[model samples]
Target: GASSSVFSASSLASSLLSPFSSAVGLASSGFVSAAFSFTGDSTSFFTSSATTSACSVLGPLQHADYFGLGKLLSVRELFEARVHLGHKEGLLNDLMRPYLFGSRLGYHVIDLDKTLQHLFCALNFIAHVAYRNGIILFVTRHQQTAHMVEETARESHEFAHTRWWRPGLFTNSTAQFGTVTRLPDTVILLSTLDSVFEEHLAVKECNKLLIPTVAIMDTNCDPRLITYPIPGNDDTPAAIQLYCHLFKTAILRGKERRKKDEEAAARQQQEAAGTASDASKQPTSA
Candidate 1:
């Protein structure tokens, strides 16, 4: 029920952006370059100190409100994440190459990018849902090109501060894949469909009762295993690159929301403390 309301709102918002305008060239020329370049020192973008600080301030991901403030939606944030992620990895150039050269090779190349982009967009939609609902996002094989996703997420948060963003990264080894185990409260398992297809029955059974999965479903795999499947080419580097960007974008939007919530909580605490201190100093009621 909660997810349905959010989905309705997200769908409406998504429709507002004309399909053609979804292309990443809305801003000034060389916008692609400006957007992609993680801007001064990627380390600064997500310093070790910042990560620690965020963890401390936000507290453990386990105590987060899974069904309340976490489950919100923002279509624009999702789109921005996709564009930002793709631009960051130079995949945008590969994505656009087909359009630049209208030859047959270009057309085929473009198809892959297009499919990948569509999948990314679908995943973004799902991420928006998860973030709003305070769902935990878990990524299997964290070492496999996860940095690209994390970097884009960091950039997206830097730019947009909103209520539907909380970015998190998790590895599969630690993930207990049974009965929607709520370690992080809201778990979003991310993995390639191809990897899991061989164990289709098992994967299906795992996903059927618990856990909301957002998977990169390549042409070779069956879509049934994933709750939110983004269909595209699984083998191409470009395809993986594109999905990574999209995932990062969605995560960034979620993180932005968490930041806002933290700020609001701090303000409330400060005000409450101030009120208490002022009351203490006030003249006796008698």
Candidate 2:
């Protein structure tokens, strides 16, 4: 009776701790091995199995998150998004001087005009790539805004590494992970420079691979590092969301445009074939 009670308590504890673990049968053995062994084996099994499931499910979405490219982002939206806010003047980059309006208190304020200009260039570049069916990888190392980045990436139907920028993701793709057949054509960095960590290895790898990068660079970040550096507040949620929405819009626009072009090409081919057939059927004017 005592053994049954002990086993029941252990089983209840295990169930409470691991909801994923299967129910264990009552062990008649009063020995500690009978009780502890099943618990240990079951815990390891469920833990490993759950991890595998998560990895398999989140490997990559089946399709890009294309909710219709929507419309082009506007300056008024940028103004409202508060994307102009930046770090202190001492943190400012000289090359980014063109993108600054002036300083308020101690912080450097970003110029909405230049931001819009750069944004358009960046979005247009992204749209062009998407139109050609190129892959984009959105990367962020900041935990605070990582969820937003992942959500944006999923909605945009692109790949993302919000958790951590695994070093050599591009350079060691096939070698690091043998089954990996492809790497992203472009990388969009949510945070160009992480204050907490060392330089993002993904940035260097992208450069080495010659894969173009679009980065939301804070005033403290070096503009020369990325291919398309958009000087803005990479720390704020609102600013990141604005950029994400615009990029998603651009990607959708490009995909839509590509689809239209494809459809048009198909129609033209059909029409040309019909015209040739009609000519063949026409009586010769002798």
In model 1, the worst 10-residue window by lDDT is: 29-38
What is each predicted model's overall lDDT from 0 to 1?
Answer: 0.38, 0.66
User: What would the per-residue lDDT of candidate 2 be over residues 1-286, giving only the tens digit for each residue?
Assistant: 1121133424433322221111112322211111211221111111224334543344211111122221354556776788889888887678788788899999999976566546655665677678778999988888888888888888878888876556666787887787777888889998876547456888889888878888887777777768777878887888888888888878878788778868987999999999999999999998
lDDT of 2 at 75: 54
Instruction: Go through the candidates in order and give the clash count of each.
Output: 16, 3
Task: Please tell me which predicted candidate would have the highest lDDT against the true structure.
Answer: 2
Model 1 scores a TM of: 0.40
Top candidate (TM-score): 2
My TM-score estimates for the predictions, one after another, are 0.40, 0.72
Model 1 lDDT tens row, 60-137: 231112112222223333333332121122233242333221223222222332333344345444444445554444
